[model samples]
Target: MPLADWLDRRTGWRSLAARARADLSRPVPRHVNALFALGTVAGTFLAVQVATGVLLLFHYRASADAAHGSLEALLSEVPSGWFVRSLHAWGAHLFVATLLLHMARVFVYGGYKRPRELTWILGSVLLLLGLGFAFTGSVLPWDQRAYWATTVGTRMAEAAPLVGEELLRLVRGGEEVGEATLGRMFALHVAVLPLALLPVLGAHLWLVRRLGVSTLEDADVEERVGHARLCEGGEPFFPHHVLQEAFVANLALGLLFLLAILAPAGLGPRADPLETPPGVRPEWYFLPVYQLQKYMPRSLLGIEGNTLGFLASIPPVLLLLALPFLDRSPARAPSRRKGAMALGLLVLGLGGALGVLGYLSNRTVQAFGRTFVFDDRGFPERAAGPATEPR
Candidate 1:
């Protein structure tokens, strides 16, 4: 067979797949019409992160003593290295933001319903894994801030009840943060988690292909039919959609490069295992969880109440994982599901409130070993003191 003929046959098969997908009784929505774009945006960022991270690996040393210094050197000495680091940092934030928005869009549009349960479950797992990536990566800088923040974070895990101690040990690889801890985190951040995510992501995309895109149930079916009539018909996935994806991915990469060059991030002082920094806080993504730990009551059922707090995450996690099954109703539009809409609003409201409280709580400055008092107007006032003699 001629090479041209084989190429033509392969192209024909792909076109058939694209056409069949488009001609479904309800075609998978695209661009502004669905959450697919956000997922694509996230995937693009992930690719950026992986690429930049690999470059960083060339300069990074996994040892606790050298990791922080090596990163500093990369930012200061390695050519265009700062840009790479900044892009990785900012890209992580963008990836998480886009992913959350994508999930929210899916939930609101009823994409989790019926045959798409596995898709939703996989997305939830992806969300959690993204968080894990953020947490592990943050510690790699090994700065004073990162160290103390991780200390606070792992302490929260240690408050997790019966298995808390064991979990902490597993993560720390010992009684404390040391070489083993750094090595484990480096392995997880660069290799293990990403490897685990690939197959799941593939399955998620495959499911999306199989089940088709969920559409807005309230959209006028007749109007859609009329619009379809006026269209020039669908284009092939290869040249059209695939080209757009490549453009978007390139744009993301360019932005990352610009960030890495223009606003190269800096490392703070190296971690001192014996010292605790004041106002220690985890990465911004973790603020809500850390704040949740703070608000948990002192005790429950004769156990530390934070254990209950940790356990409370179970229901939400399960709900997120099982969303596809729970939302089995035929409704596919936000306006059609009042209960789900209300629940979504409630979750958003709670998250916003917790985030605000977390920021405010961390802003409370302590001085002289006493709780710093604030005035009624929310400003710190010097505790009433004797008038000082003129200096």
Candidate 2:
């Protein structure tokens, strides 16, 4: 007689609802502590991104000719547009950060074992998709900073072995970034990547539901170390764990709001093909790879150094994706899994250090008839003046 009964009679909506409730109420692993709530926090930011992104679409012009103008008007004229834009911008940063933390947590706990291999792989793919979003979004603004940053990023793809030039052509829609490029990027950003990402996201969540939360005890960590340190069994996913996740999600949203208000996203000058910024770099997430490329020798064993550096970056990523296969040991404890722990720490620390170096690389100085630019990976060159304009 009721709406629920009507829907249930017509479309079996009640059964689907029952299934969802069952999934939500399933017991999570006891070892999943407060830190595990980060995945939920990241998920919350993703929802924010989608919501604000849709709002942005109403006013955004996906052409290089008008994209920058559209953005400027959005910030300056549209009602609450700045807030929506800022939320989308800042939400992206938080989404990527939270996902990185979540992945690190999973890695440290050895959660990517036999049955969970696909889960880890899906998460890794999602991280890559996040970067894809970053790449496509960077160009959408059509501002000087966005344009140059995209230029640097696309050029790096040219280091790929055989299909290098073709990859460049494919991404930029021609030889250079222009209207065609913007059109292609817009399609990818608004249509392609999101279409790909949502299905992958759905599958990842389904895998999580199917596999159940991995336990440190399953990996023999609790057995090696006394059982006192680990939780004996998990609480329900409903009230207890869901409440903690909700708290984390709310905190993340509140922080995002404050950041949007205090430090709103900025738009630089319009894109100019003739003018190149003195030192252009990719986003922070891509900086480690950029720094690595910069540090590599011009020629390596008679091969192009950029190519070698590009190749060098692949193995670590491959190893990350192939971790379940590489580390067959069942031990999950930090003390028990020394090799895995060291490797993980090395990768994490190196990435963090390189990111810091990249951020600090904007400094420039002149001494002894030579100009030194930290952004060029500490290279010194003889120049008429400083690399950047004088203040």
Candidate 3:
């Protein structure tokens, strides 16, 4: 048989299987839940970011010397380029925000327990990967601000005690940022990270299928047993939920395109290798981590260490990774899991507090005339001089 004919023959069977599975796994609740809606919203934004990123790649140039100028030209010259870039930028933020919200909902609702633990763990990895995507993409603009901000970022990494120097060298591809660094970052941002995420994401969805969607405690599962009983049986995945997902996805795509057309991204001047810019900051997603680095004591246990900084970051990282295991209660309702509920609130409170303190530290440093300002070449223009001329 011709391939087309074979595919056509299989379509009906495929649809039937999908419908059967959906009917079996559908929520027992009569009303659609808000958590379900929120996940859909987040999934929509993720699709937008992926699509826009691909479009932007068509116009992006990777060379450090030309990358910044090319981005500027794309904004000014390409038709509707500004809107596309802005949508891409804003979409990134939206994606992170929505994912965070989704995770919170899952945590509070006891969605991470027992059979669903793997799903939650995979989702956490996805969150970290999303963050990596954001950080790598941020530096591609190659503006003075972007360059020096990344410099400070890498230095913070290098501050790790024993292994820090090696790790920094691996990230930078050398002692300093240059073409190699840009190329490596771009590769990781576009190629490596995506490749790494794909299998994990597939596994996550598979687990969702195997374990099934979580439900509020009040819903009875026995009611959702039959296939043909429309009122009692779950809706068909194809015409019901799948169609809804499609509609939401297309709506998100439309909005992203509209944004891209209305306001393309703007680019700063080309990064000069010789100078640095003042008040350089990272993308908003990194604000918490960046802030944490500031408040952590320079040393711990009198060991004389930046090791403390490295160690300080470990808890949050581990907590995020270990959430699936940490939340092992049998209860699946937010109200029932008091310990998890309290922990979630504590994490949020700490994050907010640390962010505020970090911001205050920056302000204090600037007030004391100790903050490093950068020149156009992305090098720090030192504030404290040799104190030589007075003699």
Candidate 1 regions exceeding 4 Å error are 1-35, 218-262, 364-391
Winning model by lDDT: 2
What is the C-alpha lDDT profile of model 3 across 250-294, one tens digit per residue? Answer: 676676667656655667767776877656666666666676666
TM-score top scorer? 2
lDDT of 1: 0.74
Q: Over the stretch 1-391, how does candidate 1's per-residue lDDT look in tens digits?
A: 5885698687876687667666543422343332356778889898888988999999999999899889989989998788788988889888888889889978877778765678889989999999999988888999998888877777767766678999888888888877787888899998999998899899998887665555444334423554333222444343465556567666766776677667767788999998887667777677776677666678867877778778765777787887666665677667778888897898788777766666655354455554544432234555434433335
The alpha-carbon deviation from the true structure for residue 32 of candidate 2, after best TM-score superposition, in angstroms, is 2.2
- lDDT, each prediction: 0.74, 0.85, 0.71
Segments of candidate 3 deviating more than 4 angstroms: 1-6, 9-32, 218-264, 359-391
Writing each residue's lDDT as its tens digit, candidate 2 over 1-391 gives 6987888899998889888888777777776778988888989999999999999999999988899999999999999999999999999889899999999999988888756889999999999999889788888999998898988888888998888899999988899988988898889888999999988999999987776677776555534554334533567788789998898888889999999999999889999999998768888999998888878888977889889888988998898789999988877777888998999999999999888787767656665655665545634333546445456
Top-down TM-score ranking: 2, 1, 3
How many collisions between residues are there in candidate 1? Answer: 3
Estimate the lDDT of model 2: 0.85
| Model 3: how far residue 262 lies from native, Å | 6.2
